[model samples]
Target: SNHQSWVDTSIVQYISRDRLPLTRFFTKFELIYIPIVGQTFYFLDFPMMRRHSKQAVTKNPALAGKDIIEAKRACALLKDKPFTLLNYLEGTRFTPKKRNTQQSPYTHLLKPRAGGLALAINALGDEIDGILDMTIVYPDGVPTYGELWQGKIKRLGVDVRHIEIPDELFASLQDGGYENDSATKEQMFAWVEHLWRQKDERITSMLAEFEE
Candidate 1:
């Protein structure tokens, strides 16, 4: 998803029903200390990373690489079951102002943060079956999360493509793994970029239909 709104999750979940299991999302470790909801996510076993601010990491260099360890440990729980993991690769909700400032190549997306996904895949590549690449769109315009619950949202769209894991991707987790290996990481990023390009076109094509 380009992440225009929080409503995307429920919309996608409705459309994808039965095609996948209930999804567990990755959360920031800080959220785990929040009131009820955060604890619920912890109980539900959502992977949580204690993300470091750049300034914080700069102040304490040892904090680097800690997220990788947490993600790896969390993924261990998924090894014995068929689980759906949801990641918002865009990392944040999109706004035209933000997109322009970023000078993103795709017309409708933020540049994906590849590291979180890469680390998860590398750590649990063996336990995973395949990846589902899904694109979510709102034709009229982005809606606020409130608009969704109020039944004010109009047309919504979803497209899905599945990708199989290549054996070589996780061939050696012991030797620094996917995150540490420059070549493999780049390969994954190339794949993500290719998908984003297609998603840009797909949204364009879809919107054109509404225009017609």
Candidate 2:
């Protein structure tokens, strides 16, 4: 599965080779809801990822404004450090059937949950200037984490594209209050949607190339 492939890949291998200074600001449940070994993760000093539930946040006036503030604090903790923050925008993996059922805006990816990324960017500010957009391709089929651990699945490919955020988006954030400002939030959301659209196009072209 992709887990083993991830271990074998250049990106993961390179990161593992060095004792990198990094903190992961990931989704909360991955750390909290695990069965027996969840508590052990806290020993590593990885911050407990927390995100407000969509419904709860929307309903509560106090919580509605907390996302950006919390994200800023998280980003502040990681500033000037060579750390990797893995945020899964889709919030879950994709299967072909799910893709069909969801009719996602992006052909290659599940629907992106934009709120987390928006907060991260607002928090990180100029600290994060580039993004390495990674595409994991499983020509045979998508594999589960268990399959990957057992060494049952193999033959995977990865493509990395380093994308620069357009200056306008950065400038908008720099103006301050991106989260609370309705106009700025809309602009950022539109920009991200455009990026996802392009990603869809790129993935389609790449898959066609592989087929040929």
Best by lDDT: 1
Over 111-137, each residue of candidate 2 has an lDDT whose tens digit, in order, gives: 766666666676777787566665666
Q: Stretches of candidate 2 above 4 Å error? A: 1-23, 29-40, 174-178, 209-212
Prediction 2 TM-score vs. true: 0.75
lDDT of 1: 0.76
What lDDT would candidate 2 get against the real structure? 0.61
Clashing pairs in 2: none
Query: lDDT by residue for model 1 over 1-212, one digit each (tens)?
Result: 55778787787678668988767777887897799979998887777766677798899999877767777888786666667888788889888888898998878888887766776675676576777877787788888888888998778777788866555654643234554677877776876787789888988887777777
In candidate 1, the residue pairs with backbone N, CA or C atoms under 3 Å apart (3 or more residues apart, or in different chains) clash, namely none
* C-alpha lDDT of residue 59 in model 2: 85
